[model samples]
Target: MSKQVIALAYDGRNAPSVTAKGDDALAEAILAIAREHEVPIYENAELVRLLARLELGDAIPEALYRSIAEVIAFAWYLKGKAPVGFGQRDDGDAPLLLSGPER
Candidate 1:
């Protein structure tokens, strides 16, 4: 209910996992850690509310595939690639979460 923050982790093969989440002060800590780590931050209150219900390490719900896919793709585009070490292979041509390059 309080200002919430949810963090997800993804590899190019599997569904994204809910790696971290929190409310209120914990939410602030999550955001701070993300900033300190240079992690991409996505704001979608609707989606956050939905995802926040998920437990840590739980892959996103199938119903959220399309929405989450869009978010990942957008994040990839914004970053020019998935953030380093986010399951990015050494191959150097890895697309965002198994998705082909964004044209």
Candidate 2:
């Protein structure tokens, strides 16, 4: 399978931003860094594709809040960290961001 990885950074101040993205070699490199740094990595092809469409450093769009929130929640669970509210909840529902080691 081809390697597809997208890196996101959420500081609880602004919307989450896509920080990096790559395929093949660069994708492998991204995974390597995550492994070395103990960053939680979640493999979601659909999500990766959506995130890949974002320009590096662009905050995720509103339409993606719910989906991305879910990803963050899962990552937090995996790393044993609590999921925290992310920015604002458009639907007036609970939204969470993943918290873990450096993203």
Candidate 3:
């Protein structure tokens, strides 16, 4: 099977959308751009298979929300970012720091 890759974009307010998808050479290009930009990469063949069914700019189906959410959360954790209202306080922008799994 050709190596497949799917990219998703989420705005915290809406469902994640399929921003890109490709196989083989196209996949390598997409992944290279992501690496150059320091975007975290998550690998799951099954998830990619499911997401590949979506067209570009299409929001993910509700059934995949939890699975996609987990991937997004993992990416956020890898980037050291927390979603708004996540352990925030009234004082300022200080967010609660949680330990991540060992790499």
- The per-model lDDT (C-alpha) reads 0.69, 0.67, 0.70
Q: Model 2 over residues 1-103: C-alpha lDDT tens digits?
A: 5667788876655788877777777778877787787777776677777777788889899999998877876766666565346443332222222222222
Per-residue lDDT of candidate 1, residues 1-103 (tens digit): 3577778877767888887777777778777787786666777777887886789879899999999888887867666665557675332322222111111
- Model 3 whole-model lDDT (C-alpha atoms): 0.70
At residue 97, candidate 3 shows an lDDT of 14
| Local accuracy of candidate 3 as per-residue lDDT tens digits, 13-77 | 78888887788778877878878877678888777877878898898899999988788778777
Model 1 residue runs over 4 Å out of place are 82-103
Residue-pair clashes per prediction, in order, are: 0, 0, 0
Predicted structure with the largest TM-score when compared to the true one: 3
Pairs with steric clashes in candidate 2: none
On lDDT, the stronger of 2 and 3 is 3
**Candidate 1 accuracy as TM-score:** 0.76
Q: Rank the candidates by TM-score, best first.
A: 3, 1, 2
Off by over 4 Å in 2: 83-103
- The prediction achieving the highest lDDT against the true structure is 3
